[model samples]
Target: MNQSRVTDFILTGFPGLHQEYYGLVSFVLFLVYFVTVVANVTVFFLFATNRSLHKPMYYIILNVSACDLLFSTTTLPKIISRYWFQSGRISFNGCFVQMYFVHYLGSVNSFIFLLMALDRYCAICHPLRYTTIIKKCTIHILSVTAWIVGIGAPLALVIRAYPLPYCGSNVINHCFCDHIGITVLACTDRSPYSFTAFVGAMLTLLGPLAFIVFSYGSIFVEISKVADPKSCVKSLSTCSTQLIIISLYYVPRCFVYLASQVGITFSAGLRIVIIMLYSLVPPMINPLIYCLRAKDIRQCLIKQFYITTGRQKAQVFAVSN
Candidate 1:
């Protein structure tokens, strides 16, 4: 069978979306990209400048921030341009590259969340050995391992999907290139590739989620045994921020992925909305949810703010004199 392979793919930002709403949608996406970049960059800046934040937990946070930043950058810009300038076309190879980073960063996030859960569990459950167990070297090793695994896992999917005969449609229903969105466009039988992707996605999402659940379960049990109400409240508060971020990241994603796998029918627009929410919102608010509220980070930001203000005032006085 002779077929003309497509060399480009068109990304439909939102199927059935009106041309009139393009500006509005593009503006909204730009805002999300802007905020996510600024917030995660601020996190990087804080971590770099503050020596006191050089600990295991904050190191995990640093990894998370970097992952979130890269993920948002990988996805948001092209979609924004799609809506804003009516430019939705991506080269075949470029699309595959984007797909790789999207999945890779997302998998890295899942592992980072597991690392966070482990950190909390140790701090609450084994205070005496927490420092010894989760050292800087250990975090470095684990984080490097996460990056390697995350990179390797998605490469398989891309390799399998990229060579498939894409002789039919060149339109991707989703905003970005992903395994499902890309593989479904191929003319050949996709069951093998789909099943492979399904299993990989499940492992990437569920494996870490299971560990996180166990870690937090143990944390709650330990917290309950504490006699002092103040100590209990503090422990719960510390865990709450992480819980909220984790829920935002994992719940909607699991829902979307499972819904698609199970043949649950839904509108493309609604699915895209859900995907955007889960993908963009967590990174945008992570700094606010975790870093800004942290006592040490807050102190560092305040101290820096005052110093900058003082320097400005001193410069003004010198100019006047």
Candidate 2:
């Protein structure tokens, strides 16, 4: 028996979605893409313009914003086009490229989250040494290292899956090209590759999550011992916000991976929905949770708004004269 190689893969946005809802789905995805880009860009602008935000914590936030922006750009446009313009087909090389960034930036985010947890732990647990430990230089180095590590970690996945003989079924059931989604379409038995990807995914997801839990646990304990009520409340509020963002990113992802590994059954549509929620929601809301809520960023935004508004009024007065 002979088989022909698959040169392109068709992305099925949602397996069960009807044509009638394509417009609505595309509109929603367009909205998400728009928000994700704008929100992350705002973070970039803030970090670049405001020298006051050039600290270790804000550096980590900047890294996260970049990752979010890149990840959304990689995955969302193709899928949105799939639903909107009815162009869901991606070339083999293009699919692999998408798969690489989807996992690469995701790993970068996980590492950044770990850095954030470490930052907070030091600030709350070891305040005296926090400044010394997590300095601008230190974070810059760590963040650079994270990006480097992120690049190599997901390369293995692409390398392993890319050469596999994909002879049949070029349709990907999900919105984008991911390791599991692409590998399953291979003609060979995908069990080994799937298992390898699963192990890699778990390690990527769980390693940082465990540390985040420990860091926050310690922070909570420290907060309890603080005598000042105001300080305790402020500390709790900060940690709680971080935890919410963390949960949004990690929990659904872990569940999806675990379910697949354990032979649990779920609808393809449901799985895609869960994946979208975990992938897109955090980036959209991160600006609100991390940037806008911060006192410095809020004040800076207000100050900028007024300055821009005053400039516009002055221009109008000049034109009137």
| TM-score, one value per model | 0.96, 0.96
Off by over 4 Å in 2: 258-264
Worst 10 residues of 1 by lDDT: 289-298
Model 2 over residues 1-321: C-alpha lDDT tens digits? 899999999999898889999999999999999998988888888778889888888898888888899899999999999999999999999999999999999999999989989999998899999889989999999999989987876899999889999998999998999998999888889999877887787777889899999999999999999999999999877666567777888888878877977999888888789888889888999988875567777777777789889999999999999
Q: What is the Å distance of residue 29 in model 1 from its true position?
A: 1.1
How many clashes (backbone atoms < 3 Å, residues ≥3 apart in a chain or on different chains) does model 1 have? 0
Instruction: Write the residue-wise lDDT of candidate 1 on 108-152 in tens digits.
Output: 999999998998899889999998999999999999999988987
Give per-model CA RMSD: 1.4, 1.5
- Could you tell me which residue pairs clash in candidate 1? none
